[model samples]
Target chain A: MLDSALSVFRMGRNMARLMEGLGVTLEISVVAVGLSLIFGVPLGLMMAGSNRPLKWLLRGYLEFVRVMPILALLFIFYYSLSKFWNINLSALTVSIFVFTLWGAAEMGDLVRGAVTSLPRHQWDSARALGLSEGQVSFRVIIPQAIRRLLPGVINLTTRMIKTTPFVFFINLPDLLKVGQQIVEVSGLRYPLASVWVYGFIFIIYFVICYPISLFSRYLERRWAS
Target chain B: MRRARFLIVALALALAMIVSVKAQAGDLDDIKAAGKIRIAVFGDKPPFGFIDENGANQGYDVYLAKRLVTDLFGSPDKVEWVLVEAASRIEVLQANKADLVLANFTVTAERATQVDFAKPYMKVALGVASPKSALISKVEDLKGKTLIVTKGTTSDTYFSKNHPEIKLLKFDQNTEAFNALRDGRAAGLAHDNTFLFAWTKDNVNFVTGIDFLGDEDTIAPAVKKGQTQLLAWVSERIEKLIAEGFFEKAYAATLAPAFGPAVDPKSVLIEKLN
Candidate 1:
């Protein structure tokens, strides 16, 4: 127990190097998820309310984003943009761009689900009150659907945070990448170095993600009850 | 529901069998009889093995695998190329996912205990590169600066063991490390000298400093441990191929496009071992 405790302290000193990486991870996750909500909500509303042709085109796009692997899409964007146009953007930009694409599709689907699940009477009642079609969606439907959208959005935020590790493939020095580098550097010092480093990473992930997940659950329970 | 469940289970079993069959390692005669050899080559590293812009697999290691397979099976098409990364090339060979790995694989004593290496086919050493504007040239210049290295590479191990003061960023792929250097996120990118030579040649903005780090090492193909028959056959075939100028032809065809005119096969090739 004493030996293990000493190792943890040693590893803690090393792991302090990863704070900047954690900051990077949180920064990108917030930007990607925020962008997803900003754009995805409107796209979702369009899919829900638009004409058949527009809806079909939007649906096709959503499906494409949903089905395509994020990692593969990241490579396509990273390599193709750099090779063809000489636009060698930073890894953080590429990551935020790809995650926005993925998160938006997911958020759009959530919006569609939440909006569609509302009874037809809700739409009719809003229109019955002198509200125009746009006003009905904006003032009546979306306001009520906000409760339902909250839990799903929070869930996606957690997932986006989890998936930030893929940015390492493009050379973004995010949390997981830093952890890997730490392990590579210090793993040989003691057999427990990897365990300490990886365990600390796991705990850090838990601390960040657990609270968000709990908040999501609390929101779900609050709304449901 | 019961019948559907049965069908699903049967299908899963069949799929499992097929996957297991695909991963089986063949002995020397079984491989020849099967009329195909599965070789793992790095899909990221250039000049040795990599996927071309056209999406076709092409490079020195790839050319050698094709020639070796054709010489054995009488057809170039009788070879399967499995794309492997630096860290898992030997694991792929050990797992029977590949019969041989020709992925610019340097023979290390630690790796030799896990996989059997054929005779040396090329000589290589660690090379460090930095941006031209940085004026960062050698190992000493890397003090208090971040250097990028691919994970599980000799450079990563070397720096971790020797120069612990130099902060290192480890990327899983070579392209990522190069990108780090390109983006100015890292002061230097260190890896095999041959690869650095090719990289600096292609991207002139970066200059190679510290042309060689540590002692020189030899690159060779690796097979699964205890596969003595396969090992002997591969070693003998490489020696014969070297004597018959097969490597020279391969070098001219694949690497000469990137490595330029002065590279002679004999300087890199090792042959005629028991």
Candidate 2:
């Protein structure tokens, strides 16, 4: 069984191709997460502020993203946007765009939740100290909110990573797609190829996501102390 | 008020981006100007369009695509390959992601409405492969039994439309459909006979007992709808290739080894144009 399993990797460059696929997956996740943080933090701050119209608008965006399926979003951006709108983005670009949109929305919601969860007295007390609104926001609220937001942010990053496989439908050769290709080709010689190939993919995903979750847990404990 | 104005400007810019560029299908001249033809092929379906162990595209469809590119640009390297799944074949063309689709795309009436098919290079029919223990040899044999098919394939269309009595289990990819068959999640797996012939050879336990099902169909290259100049050029090129017996060489190179001695080349190859 082990020999048969190892035979999958022995096939020409299957391991390397899988690694390349992993690279694509990480590339999408990292860029999406980076963009999400850059945009989401500010949007969350605005949503938590006194601007009712801005809050309502961000709320609508968040709800739309939450209600719609990621797969549908990917299809719309990759196919319909290009065909009807003539915005010809490559599959990878479209994947990143959709995921970033989703990640930013989720991150914004997380930030809003963390901020709103704080007691009204925390704000009143900070204001009573004669700190200006900007100073209160920067010195008092954001630091506390960051502690509350860290776990959710890390969780979203891992979710985005796992969700990266959905890009396969649009024909981006991510890790899962590449693994399926390897299994199909190797199945000609080894009938048990899928077991090993999918198993290896499982291991790769676990290796990526487990470390992230562990880091989140470590931060949560340290911050709580 | 400032935020609202900023949002309006952003929306206007987005609308401008949308309306500025008109979606036009690339013609032969456009392809020549670009210096590379984007051809979509399958990365999973073996003996047709599949990736080799070297992580490079190889198969019968890919072989033809490379030849088409070489004939067009005097070198195969001028081809930019766009790997696609079965369901996205037409969408890739419609979205202008590929100049041509050579992804074992069977010519069907429904598909013909969406994309213009070039002259056929191969012929095929739906085939059902099942375990030797309980082989499904006829359409009626699949009645009330679950049949696995890849979504958006001709087999899926045929079963869904014609044989509603059969419970169909559809997967998005060929590998998943075949895996469902191997795991006995279905009674039989239905796909193109050409693919089943190649597949059954590798999987000794399964037999394509129903070798030919449904009306015989031809597999052809497809371009986005209304690409008249490109379509005419592709048709003429296909006729020339047929006349020169390029498909026979492709069959010998790719399909012959995959099909082994049991299947004959003439059974699948379309050597002449009507």
Candidate 3:
């Protein structure tokens, strides 16, 4: 146990190398998730309202995004686009594109659920106050819905961070891919290299996601009060 | 309830049979009886083993494998090509999923313990290539730059041991390493000299430095350990092929197209086993 711990510590010294990879992962995830919410919120608000054809169109998109695995989508946009057509895209661009689509669908669905689940009387009372439909939604209903949306959005952001490893398929030097590279090379000298490298990756992921979970809890409590 | 129990028992027995069948390993006799040989080869790497536009597996390694199957089973049709990347080649052999691995598989003392290697059919050395726009002209240029290499390859092991100061980015596939170089993610890409040469020839934008690192690695067919009969069979077959100038013929067929007309097949071919 002590020997393994020492190896893990030794590996940690090279955390700077892994940090470069983490930078890429964080940048991609933040942009993808941020853009997803920007576009998704409006689409969700539209879906929540009774726009018959729009709802049906959004339902199909949401179902397709939900059912399709992120890896498959990444490949379609990365390999097939470049191979069949002459359209070559950078790995980072393809990853952000796929994740944005994924995040939009997921975020849109969460917003729809939060918006539609409120008691029907909340809308009637907002309109009863002589507020415009747009003003009622923007000021009253959306504010209440946001509190409910916060936890889901934070959870999705964590998911986005975790899924960033799939960028390796398209040759992006993301965190998990870097760890895999280190493990591959170092396995020659240290028999326990995988244990060390993968253990550190696990810890790094926990360090990232655990805080989000705590923040979500804090948000839930603050919003509840 | 009784009928359902009977059905469950039948399903359990069927599952047991399938698992046991898969667990059964093949020897030379079993391979002969089955009339088919499963060989693992690289699917993306050109001049070695790659799938062409017609979806046909064509390359030097593929040709050698076809020749081996022809000599063994009296026809080249009795072969199954399992496409493997650099990292998965050894795993496929160790798992007993492949009867032979004819990928541009390098022979090393460390790898010998995991699998038995036959007499080498070809020889190659590690070489480096960088984009034309990049200032990396020699080995010293790579001092602070990131070097790209395929994971589980000899290049990966070579750089990791020799150059600790240089940042290394390893990819699971050769195409990924090549892509990394083109994308400017890494300053240079390192691999076998023949592969680097071929790649640089096709991609005029990149140039290979004159410096070659590491020892000349002999490319040989690898078989699962403890398969003495199979190993001896492959070794003898390689010796026969070498005597017949089979490697030269394969080079003419696959590598000659990528490499210029002046490229000699004899330069890479090994006539005798060490």
lDDT of each: 0.77, 0.90, 0.80
Query: TM-score: which is higher, 2 or 3?
Result: 2
Model 1 chain B, poorest ten-residue lDDT window? B259-268
lDDT of 1 by residue, A1-225 (tens): 457535644554444556777888888988998999988898888788748998998899888988888888876676555433334555678899999999988898889888988899999988889899889978989888888788788888888899998876654567776665555434434546567667778898999999988887887788778
What residue pairs are clashing in model 1? none
Per-residue error (Å), model 2, residue B160: 10
Order the candidates by lDDT, highest first. Answer: 2, 3, 1
- In candidate 1, residue B123 scores what lDDT? 80
* Clash list (residue pairs), candidate 2: none
> Per-residue error at B184 for model 1, in Å?
47
Candidate number with the higher lDDT (1 or 2)? 2
Q: Extract clashing residue pairs from model 3.
A: none
- Candidates, DockQ: 0.02, 0.63, 0.02
**Candidate 2 chain A: worst 10 consecutive residues by lDDT?**
A183-192
Off by over 4 Å in 1: A1-13, B1-274
Instruction: List RMSD in Å for every model shown.
Output: 17.9, 4.4, 17.7
Candidate 2 CA-lDDT value? 0.90
Q: Candidate 2, TM-score vs. the true structure?
A: 0.87
